[model samples]
Target chain A: MMQQEEKLRVSTEQLEGGLGLVAAAGYINNEGGQAIADAVNELVASGCRTILIDLEGTRIINSIGISILLEILDRLMESGGTMAFCNLTPTIARTFEIMGLVQYARIFPDRAAALAALGRDG
Target chain B: MEVALTLPLVPDVELIAARAVQVMGRSLGMTDGELESVTVATVEACLNAMEHGGQTCFFVRVNTHREDGGPSLEVEIEDHGVGFDPQAPPRTSPSRILGCVAKRGWGLTLIRELMDEVDVRSRPGKTVVRMVKHVGGA
Candidate 1:
């Protein structure tokens, strides 16, 4: 048994034109994934149609975490919302590609780029 | 270099082994993308074992040494449980169309894609996933 805080820190920000940003930092393990999923789900449930997840501070992520993201992506689509990601590590970006995630959710270089893609320059 | 640990099947137990992956990789000169790749693949292997092992605990072993090409690290996770057929294809894929997402089954896929080499041996009563990542630029 080991005592460690493999916690995921999550925050939400409202951007222009109904775009919501959910930023997550830390390992996206099972617990961390759930926390992020919950945050995004809340945004979707709150009538937000566009969302971006920032992974700047995250260095490690597993399939459980990816699966959670895919679930949230599905949820967003089902509700006519959109999901995108920014600040992904090269490894994560490759993983998303291999797992066919990028085919569905768009990936931008960073938050600013993602915002610009959504036409939210302000 | 070599290290091994057994984890009791608990929630987020993979973190313990993930720490081992990091410590070993950094100590053995793995950096940046390769280190991150190995760490994540290790976590995915541990998660697969814990999810399907049907056992109280699972094992993780890390070893690093010079290979024919260069230095490399391999992480092996083992569990004694109801193993599945290794020949069977892993069920994973994000649907191109909206409203359809296969949320699960990406663990094995990610491991195979991230690591330089991957081998999974499984059957009833035991399962082992070995993932190898080459050090330095590859």
Candidate 2:
């Protein structure tokens, strides 16, 4: 796992046929968000069309972080790529709903379900 | 007990306030979920101040409260800067078209959603956001 910041870390797994996974741990704050954004951009540049962020080890996400995620999603959608998330805390899930992010990003219960959804995208 | 924090307006400094909320909420016997809610809400409130408020630093006050129904934790974030109308329409949150949220303006929304009671008072030079969360099992 590459440490994004003192309180956050991110690691990526690339699959066959333009699929990728970025599992993150710790707080998704400003530094963490930008780190994830850079990782996603790199994956997309490497020909990933569907990406799933596994947040099983993460539970805290701020609105600024969500806003950064929104920017990533918009850029991905523009390029014919997409993003999804799995294992979000209930509070984060509720906040996502409150922020209207769930409308665009498909959140699943686990990596399996998220992959199933992203597999359809690929 | 009350814990008051003066935070520098820097990137990721909001985490300090979030961590403080965790410590305070846990002392109040709040659940993990409740703690998480307040943590996120506190971060949002702080980020809003840092981003929009014209201040070098801000203040966050955490205190315990007893409501008619149960115990609660109250968080107040104060910023001395340009204030805004809380009742104004979302300046650029889009039209809820299942797309972008204008890349901003969701901080206050998230704070309100996670906290049980939220009150905001702002003027040209000052803004205060006070939010309360019940400990649950009332």
Candidate 3:
């Protein structure tokens, strides 16, 4: 069996009000999930308290990916930080709801809305 | 149309199964939502098979069929693993919900929710999960 290359891309930007934006694309399996965790940790290390993930380009995620997100959520909770998700595909939004991640993280329809809800200037 | 693939029990290979479902679903004229559900369900099924199937290789087969009402997509994932009872209490949604914070055990639940029909058959040496989604909502 040929190894399928990991395709998830993660990038972060610091926004006003100490909000950090992490954008991800591609499949969020094990490799993609690890990449996301690393990105969130990096942002947190830089003193960003609130984070919003833009998942507009992400289409598919497995249970492992969800686990990674949960880890990030736990980390944020420990530090009195918050995380939000924006631009979730219909399926992904439903998955998050089912997994109960929505209880801990906020989800918005778009980046602007998420940033606004997080009290950051869009 | 019909397609079959044999993949190693590995996490990254889930992409191949997902892409196959996507392409076949498009060719079968599935709506975007329907296609997305099928693809996700397929990948979830593959992931489960890889993690729990306890086998080195698993098989995925996809086919389109015309039922009495409309066309439907069917996918089957099979593996030679130490199969568990589908009727087991741990498979219930309540148990899964309780364990949500653990970030695991949602694969089977997600597959059941996303697919129109699901069937699981398991024995000591083999396990097979078959799922179907009807097109056109007939």
Candidate 4:
């Protein structure tokens, strides 16, 4: 088999309270990391802190993907912002816990709950 | 459309993994988290290929097929590298994976847990991993 890498699609919605709800759906592997990093970076550039990543539509994520999330978390923290993850399945949630990601990012059951925890609804 | 990707073994692994997940998930109707799982597991497998396979060029190929009588998706990611025994020993806990931090070991454990089916073939020259996940079900 030959090696292949590609990015599918990413978009974000502006929620209330300056919170940006970014939903990145697709694969995240060695090949697909840059696009994701760029997506998160785009959110930061828009001056929207308090980011919520909806993993409900996401199917895969590699270490590089984790690095991107970590970087985003760092970016948010540096700017006095926050990041939360929602729609975590058993498998995905376990991966986050094992990687010590839960130490940095908060996990929610879904998007509405995450937003509510952010103290807003939009 | 089934796409194959090849990149030089380098430090930028996650970027590639995300791209693959995008393609597979969109085509198969997988949710965001599911795509994340595939990308993460694929990254682990690719890292193993580069490190253990001892190959200059790493290969990642994905093939998607629908279930015959069910509503689900199956994707297989195969690599061309030296493979290892998947059944060697279960790491027992995720902490062991974090504590050791070995590229191949941790990723393998995570991949096994994330995907419905994880298969590894570690021959001398060609190491392939066939991973399958079912969608649209509880």
Q: In DockQ terms, which candidate is top? A: 1
- How is the predicted docking of candidate 2 categorized under the CAPRI scheme? acceptable
Give the clashing pairs for model 3.
Answer: none
What is candidate 4's lDDT per residue for B76-132, written digit by digit as tens? Answer: 445555666767875534343222332324677677877878777767667777777
lDDT rank order: 2, 1, 3, 4
Residues A19-120, model 3: lDDT tens digits: 899999888887788998888889989988888999988888887788788878887887888889999988898778767788888899998788777884
TM-score of chain A of each: 0.90, 0.90, 0.91, 0.81
Query: Model 2 over residues B1-138: C-alpha lDDT tens digits?
Result: 899999887767887888788898998899989998999889889988897789899999999877688788999999999998999754333455336356667787777778898999999899999999999842
Query: What value does the lDDT take at residue A37 in candidate 2?
Result: 92
Tens-digit lDDT track of model 1 for B47-126: 88988999899999999878688888889999999998777786556545456666677788888778988889998999
The CA lDDT at A107 in model 1 is: 93
Q: What is the lDDT of every predicted structure here?
A: 0.83, 0.83, 0.82, 0.65
TM-scores for all candidates? Answer: 0.91, 0.89, 0.91, 0.55
i-RMS, each model, one decimal: 2.4, 4.3, 3.9, 6.9
**TM-score of candidate 3 on Cα atoms, chains taken together:** 0.91
Please tell me how candidate 4 rates in CAPRI terms. incorrect
**What is the per-residue lDDT of model 3 for residues B34-108, given as tens digits with 9 covering 90 to 100?**
888888888888887887788789999999888788889999999888887777533333223222456667777
DockQ of every predicted complex: 0.64, 0.47, 0.41, 0.17
Q: Which residue runs does candidate 2 get wrong by more than 4 Å?
A: A1-6, B90-101
